[model samples]
Target: MAALIEMREIVKIYPNGVVANDGVNFSVDRGEIHALVGENGAGKSTLMKILYGMERPTGGEILLDGQPVHFHSSNDAIAAGVGMVHQNFMLVPSFTVAENIVLGQEPLRNGLLDQAEALRVTRELSQQYGLRVEPEAVVDSINVGMRQRVEILKTLYRGAQVLILDEPTAVLTPQETQELFAAVRKLVDQGKTVIFITHKLREVKEISNRVTVMRSGKVMGVVQTEDATRESLARMMVGRDVFLQVNKPPVTRGKKVLEVHNLSYVSETGRTMLHNVSFNVYGGEVLGIAGVEGNGQTELAETLSGLRPAATGTASVNGKAILNTNPRTVRLSGVAHIPEDRLTNGLALTASIDENLIVDRYFRPPFHRGLFIDYKVVEKQSADLIQEYGIRTPNGKLPVKSLSGGNMQKVIVAREFTSDPALLIAAQPTRGIDVGATEFVRDQLVKQRTDGKAVLLISADLSEVMSLSDRIIVMYEGEITGVFPDAASVSEEELGLYMLGIKRQTKEEMEAVL
Candidate 1:
């Protein structure tokens, strides 16, 4: 079959001389789900952005259905039946589902908005595409899965024949993911082509008909999905045999380094985000917090890390009070935190990489001598860490914001892992990084555990929590719904039950292990 869309010799060079895409060629079939996989900075996103008219190619030509075309803006791409759903959902919180769907192209009756027609159209599209949604439900009040369906419906309502879904399943639970896969298959069966960009190799294998691999701004190869193993695809993307599994050896649990009892948090808007949450992280073991995103995981991490004040309850590190204290106080009590939102909580974007490396310890002995930071010592430490952590950058003096996402994450890891803390609170440590970086970070977490340091791991990735934790706790709404004394003894499906509030253990059952 002839290609439905072809991008030939695409090249994107930023004004700062970064070659995002280098002589790349990509194509997709008319009704197939095609996956694009690559390491961070491999230019997969740039290529797609060019195709979607978000970026102008430095050099290339695009052909759609054997006809040459040029899209100067996203509006042009939309008019040509192309649409993109970003990793972050773009919806107005106050708008109803039907209103969000027909936002820019609302139906009109006598120079006024046609509310009835909008609901009718949304219902029609939702049923026709096999994506279920409530047209009248407010976007803010809906669940993540329902919000995603509304996004797809929005694109379809705009007459999109081709869809680009970026990291669609990043924040979805196992059950919600299956539903999305079913919906995607239905779309393809009804003649819609899809281009899926994701970091999860398993999803690539499961949802894609064909796969294209890229490395360092170039296409490595493209192959039929049935012919590719996860290992093979990972190797192609990173140019090495990446370990898809964590190599964690058995270790004896040690003294309790972190203790929390009835920890609770209420948002400024007066909504209860955490409720009576309790757990313990012992030295030489990892205690995993497993749940779907927005289910009190963020609040718990922030409260423990001193970023948020607790409404009720108490927490401590090594018997020193940490709850409701400031960040520096918690850090002084032997706590190191890798926050979930790296940009906001992890780094000072305007600071140089070397400066950021020492933000947590800038006022200490060697670096701080009589009120002046010793730049020479800081430079040496920064140089050593950059090499040790495999941070790719031209120099240590560049601002943290100038680096790619993966490198910025590496900087955070390098700083936190080397802090020598007694307890590590790692929240989504490897969320956006590639397989190689993920492997490194996971190994480091295990290393910390084996070295007799306590680790409190909170992640939305089920495989990550299951593989690394010695014990696991499941949260639903604002409470601990289930607890497994042995992480290895539980299944992903069983955990999903607690995550979706389908199952809950009595307070006595959870307290026994928690």
Candidate 2:
């Protein structure tokens, strides 16, 4: 088969002198599911951007079906039947699924948008591709998996022949991932070409026919997926023997660190979000909270961290009541929180890295002298934290937004971990980070446990929850439905049942773990 897309010695360099792609020779066969796998900072995204016309290659030639071509912008690439779906969804929150699908290329009747035609096309595409999304549902009201399906549908609706999916499975649950893989297979069977970009080797092995590996702005190698092993891919990407399993000694539970009693809150719509949620976390142990997203997990984390006002009940750190208190008070009471969303809740993106590092402690000594800001001390401390956290940046003066997703997360972790609080609230700590960073973050949590710091670990990644958690609490409809002491012994299927409110445990069963 002739190649659907081809790049010959593509070279891309930014104005900052960072060479993202260098002499990258890549190609994808027509109607094939090709995967691009690499670690953070690799040229995978760069190469894809060049192909999709989001970026202009500094050098090299691109050919489509053996014909040379140049794409000056995304519109040009789209006109050539190429489309890209970014990691972060680009849909308007207020727009309906059907409206988002036909945003740029809406059907027209006379001079106005043809709503009937849009809905009909959306429904036809949904039925044909098995993407069962309600055309009328608002984007914000749907789950992440459904939103991703919408993204795919949007591209397909635009008559895209070559689809580029960037980190598609990063946010999906196991079952949702399976569905997406099935959909990818269907698309390929229907003679569509796909270029999947991801760092997960398992997904590559499962879905890709051929895989191209890139590392540090260079193409490492390309091989058939059937011939490549996870170890081989990891070594090619990182140039090391990566330890997939996190090594931690058995946990020794100590004194009580954090306790929540009958914590309940109400949503803006006057409905109870949490009801009598009670749990206790001990020093030297990680208590994992597992639930489907929007099941009051966000509310619970906010209430416990003093980011949201608890409607009823009390939460305490080291026997000190913190419910209804402000964030500063919570921090002073021996609580440190690693918020779920790093951009909105955890960081000031426009601020310098040094300022973000000292955000939690700017008022304390060393960072502050009476009423004056201590620039020297702050700079030194930020430098030390940056080194300790392995943050990759030229200097602390750079804005936090300049760093990659993993590096930004490192800054947040460095700030919170350096505080040495008695109770740590880590919510989705490894979300959106690469595999290496995920392992590092997990190791840090284990180290905190070893240091006798109680951790309330709320994560949507079931594997992470099962691996690091000393105990597990499953939430359903804003309430604790089941508690398990042996995290490794529990099955994902069983957790899914509790998460979906299909199963529940009696108060006696829950009390034993609590």
Candidate 3:
């Protein structure tokens, strides 16, 4: 059979002289789910963006059904039966699922939108595709998994024959992920093609028919799923053997390092973001918080890190109340924070790598002489960290923006881990980095726990939570729905139900351990 889509010798060069894609060749057959696996800066997203008309390739052409085509914009690609669902959902929160789906092309009767027809069509699509979404449910009121279903349905409703999904399972639980695989198979059975882009190697093995690996803006190889293992795929992507499982020793609980009681946060809009939240994190143990993206995780991280203040609660770091204090005060209290968005909250991109590494320590005696920063000490610290962390950089004096995503993340992790803090707050610490970097970060977190440091880990990736935490807590709608003193007690599927608010532990069960 002829290929459904083919991209030949694709090359993309940015104005800053970054070659995102270099003479790449990729193609997919009809009714096949092709997996694109790569590191953060490996050009998988850029190549797909070019195919979806989000970016124009500097050199190359896309052929659809054996015919060369040019897409000036996303509209052009959509008109040609291609659709993309980004990692972040793009939906109007106030709109219902049906209205959001039919926003661009709604059925009309008597010069008005035909709401009845819209609901009927949505019902039919949901049934036909096995998406299982409620037509009238408002987007804001739905969970992350349901919102993802709405995105898939929207693409199918737009007459998309080739669907491009970027990090579809990044925010889903194990059970929801199984359901999505079922829907993907259904789409393929109906003769549609799917291109799945992800950092997850296991998902590729579970749901894809073929796997393609890319590295440094080039295709390394493509192989049948049956012929690929996580080890093999990872090796292709990163040029070495990578550990898929996190190695951790048994937990030995130590002194209590963090305590929060009746924590409540109200936003500027007078909305209660967190309600009666309470937990304890101890040295030599990592406390993992698992939830969908918007389920008060951000507020909790910010409040605990001194970026936001809780309305009604008391929180202590190392037996001292540090609520509402500035970051410097929190650091002085022997606390370190690895925020969720590395680019935004972790680093100053334009600053030199040396400068970024010493921001928290520049005022110290050794690094600071009188009123001026000691350049010799700064240079030594930067060189030591770069060597110890294995950061791939030409020099410490170069701007941080010159480094790759994984290296930039290493700089943050190295600095935070070396701070000798009693408490560490790591929120999505390895979100978009590669397999190697993720393994390193997880090991570092476990190392801190092993060294008698308290860790609070907040992540959307359920696997990270399960593998690293000594205890697990599930949050939904700003409330603690369940708590497991043992991380191994609940399966990912069981934990996902609580994440979606489908099931909740009794008050007795949650209160005793939490």
Candidate 4:
């Protein structure tokens, strides 16, 4: 059978002479779940962007249904029955799901937005695809899984026979992920072709019929899913055997490094985000905050890191009050934070890697000369850290924006991990990074714990939280729903229950452990 989509000899080179995609030949069969797996900067995204018309290939030939096609914009791709759902959702929060679904192509009645017709179309598509969503619910009030279904229905409403899902399950619970997988299977059974892009090898093995691996701007290998092992695919991605499991040695818990009591935060919009949250991280142990994204996890991390002010309560690091203080003061109080949004809070994108590496301590000690900054010391330190952290850059002189997502994360990890803090707050530290980089980051976090440093971990990846956390706390709607003293004893499903507020421990029960 002929493939539904095909790209031949595709090549894309940026103005900076970076070869994003080199001679790439890719094809997706009709009604098949084709997974595109690769490390960061492996060219998978570039290839998909070209297909979705977000980017133009420097050189390539694309064929759909055995006919040549060129897409100048996303509208062109949508017209050609191709649609993409980006990692970040593109829905308007204030609008209803139905309105968001039929946003651009609203049903017309007397030149007005036919609301009844929009809801009808949304319900029809939702039922047809088994992607259940409430037509009347505001987008802001819906869960992440439902919002994702709305996104998919939006594409299907536009006649997308070929769908591209980019990191679709990156923020979903295990149950939600399974629901999405079921919906995808239904779509495939109904003659829709899906191109799945993710760094998760387990999902690749479970969901895809075939997998294509890419590395260094080129296709490394393509193989049947049943015929490939996770280890094999990971090896192909990074050109070496990657350790999928973390080996953390047992450590003796010591002094309390961080203490939070009745911490509460209200957003700028006056919505309560964190409510009476309390936790303690002791030296030589990892305390993990596990929850669905936006359930006060970001607010909690930001408040504790001094990025945001707390409405009530207290947080102290090593017997010193840190809450509501400046980030620099928090750092000086022996707290190092790896912010969840690296591009926004972590790095100076336009600055050289050397400059970013020394931002926290550029004014202290050796780098701070009497009348001038010591570039020699800064350059040497940056070079050493670049090698030590395995950041894929030729030199430290290049702007941080020039590196890939994983490399940029490595820059943050290098700086934060080397700060010699008593407490480390790692928020989604390995998110959006490939398996190789994820393994590296996980190891570093574990190292901090084993070295007698208190580590506070917040991650949407449930498996990661279970594996790396010594103690786990589940949050729901800005409150602590449950606390597990032994992370290994609890299952992801159990954790998910607390995460969704389906199960809850009494406040006294949680306080006993806390």
Clash number for each model: 0, 0, 0, 0
Q: Rate residue 231 of model 1 by lDDT.
A: 98
Give candidate 3's TM-score. Answer: 0.96
- Per-model lDDT: 0.93, 0.90, 0.92, 0.94
Candidate 3 per-residue C-alpha lDDT over 306-352 given as tens digits, one digit per residue, 9 for 90 to 100: 88988999999878998888788988899899998888889999999
**RMSD of each predicted structure:** 1.1, 2.6, 1.6, 1.0
Candidate 4 lDDT tens digits, 1-514: 8889999999999998989999999999999999999998899999999999999999989999999999999999999999999889999999999999999999999999999999999999988999999999999998888888999999999999999999999889888899999999999999999999998889999999999999989999889999999999999999999999889899999999899999999999999999999889999999999999989999999999989999999999999999999999999999999999999999999999999999999998799999888999999999999999999888999999988899999999999999999999999999999888999999999999999999999999999999999999999999999999999899998898888888999988988989
Q: Which pairs clash in model 4?
A: none
TM-score of each: 0.98, 0.91, 0.96, 0.98
In candidate 1, which residue ranges exceed 4 Å CA deviation?
none
Instruction: Compose the digit string of candidate 1's lDDT tens values, residues 440-500.
Output: 8999899999999999999988889999999999988889999999999989888888899
For residues 51-97, could you state the per-residue lDDT of candidate 2 as single tens digits? 98989999999999899999999999988999898988999989999
Pairwise TM-score winner, candidates 1 and 2? 1
Model 3 residue 337 distance off true place after TM-score fit, in angstroms: 0.6
For model 3, the superposed segments whose C-alpha errors exceed 4 Å read: 109-112
By lDDT, the best candidate is 4
Better of 3 and 4 by lDDT: 4
